[model samples]
Target: MADRVVAHQGAACWATLFTHAHYLPCLAVLLQSMRACQTRYPLVVMVTETVDARTRERLARMGCVLRDVDAWRVPHADGSLAFERFQNVWTKLRAFELYEYERVVMIDSDMLMCHNMDELFDLPLERGMIAAAFACTCNPKQIPTYPAEWTPRNCGYALRPHPPNDARQLTKPTYRLINSGVVVLEPSQEQQAEIHTFILRHTERVAQYRFPDQDLLADVYRDRIQMLPWYYNALKTLRQCHPDLWNDGEARIIHYILDKPWLLGPSPCGEHTHLHSLWWDAYASLAAHPATLSMTRDEWANEIALHVRGI
Candidate 1:
């Protein structure tokens, strides 16, 4: 028989961040989710601002390749919570360029996975981008939707000292809001240039504005992206969209959007105790697992104790 042609299995990378001290457990949740995916991708790369000694040790024990960002080098845009989150993504985008990888998946700490995401890399992200949601606001749909000022400062909305209350609350979803948590980024030289230009121009907008990061991206990549299944980012919205699928034990990922398991624990979705319990059990089990964090019961208790007192 003729020799079979083996497909080229290019390398893929995963990225995430953990700066807020209390979010380490959530980061653990993310790690657990990643571990569940039975892919042979090289080490998962994580970026952090300020991780404590014990937490750092715990992560090291879990076989993660950790990288720390120079806080001084990272510009401090005084206002906006969204900007702080996107900044991590920006850092990952920059770092991914230096690393020689065929593709990279950038996920947020607030997500939980139930299956392998290697399929994301199989898609042609080089042609465009892959996001969970589309555009999710009207501003981006209006005339001249995408403002020229894409960098943090140049964005239409000027930086505000106080967080807008509206921004904090999860208002009604207008357009398809691309879930920044899970995305497939194919890093080519041209793509890197686009990412840099987009961030430099739109970052200020994200910094100064409230909830427009996804909107800005929608505008920028309006014609150059593909939308994956909602379950991929599976949050509260998915529950409403596919009550049966979300509850039918078919979801590949259980994204706890508003009721993040790491912070508040499981949810009470519409009195659906079963669904809520499933989420809780999945999270608790992941938290208790050794692969995620090697913290003992006592150490875990102490960590939460400090959290309760806000120390």
Candidate 2:
């Protein structure tokens, strides 16, 4: 994103991205969650050029390390984005360019934290290894817009029990599908350049990827990828669709992959009222913070509640 990401090479940290001001609330809640958990790692918030000054100032005041990003200039054709909502996500590739940190965990902004996950920084990541959880392509809500291949059985984590630790994962690999939502990577200028070259040469193929940057990352790092316990990137739908694999108490982060609770769109995997409450509670804490939500809390809550539907 910046002309160059010159972070010190020995530090490890947490990071996230936001392309626009609308996602400010989600990013705020995530930052608050990190502080709540008392993590030692600093959060480097990557911002696209379009982000407003006020929002930028707010984030700075909250103690986030702001990095300006320039979108990768993907030659996106009509309907090329994996989802209509994923505008400018290609800028996420900028995370890999942060060649300063010894290792960086790029957590997607649209997720909720359950507890501190600082131990992730201490995990074994060899020079070329990129660690992440397998994506649950199980389109549980049966959203017709999603491809038919997104089935429960096709999901890499469907029947596998919760991994005790990284040994079952980092040592011997099982599945190939990797979710880009959460990534623990050792950033390097070489890999960043290689990824840029991959995107440039494979534009047509990369544009058709189901999850844009996600598929591209998988294709590039297939053999070098490692898995964390699913709880690290726990998809919300797992509770309803992959019940056998869902355990709330064990969760480290809850990736709201399908739809964000803040959007109050049709609830993903039916109504997980408790999950919604957790999101709201985090959001509510930021009521006193500057320039967040627009409406009175009661008014917005009532409006959002009406739109949230059960399957």
Which candidate comes out best when scored by lDDT? 2
lDDT of 1 by residue, 145-198 (tens): 233332323221121311112332223233224656666665568766775576
The worst-scoring run of ten residues by lDDT in candidate 2 lies at: 302-311
**Model 1 per-residue lDDT at 14:** 73
Over 4 Å off, model 2: 1-9, 159-174, 265-270, 288-311
State how far residue 213 of model 1 sits from its true place (Å). Answer: 4.3
Model 2, global lDDT: 0.73
Please report how far candidate 1 places residue 276 from its true position, in Å: 4.6
- Model 1 residue runs over 4 Å out of place are 1-8, 42-45, 70-98, 135-177, 199-209, 241-247, 265-276, 286-293, 303-311
Model 2, 67-118: lDDT tens per residue?
8877766666577565776656778879988867878999998888878998
What TM-score number comes out for model 1? 0.67
Candidate 2 Cα RMSD after full superposition onto the native fold (Å): 6.0
lDDT of candidates 1 onward, in order: 0.52, 0.73
Worst ten-residue run, lDDT, model 1?
Answer: 155-164
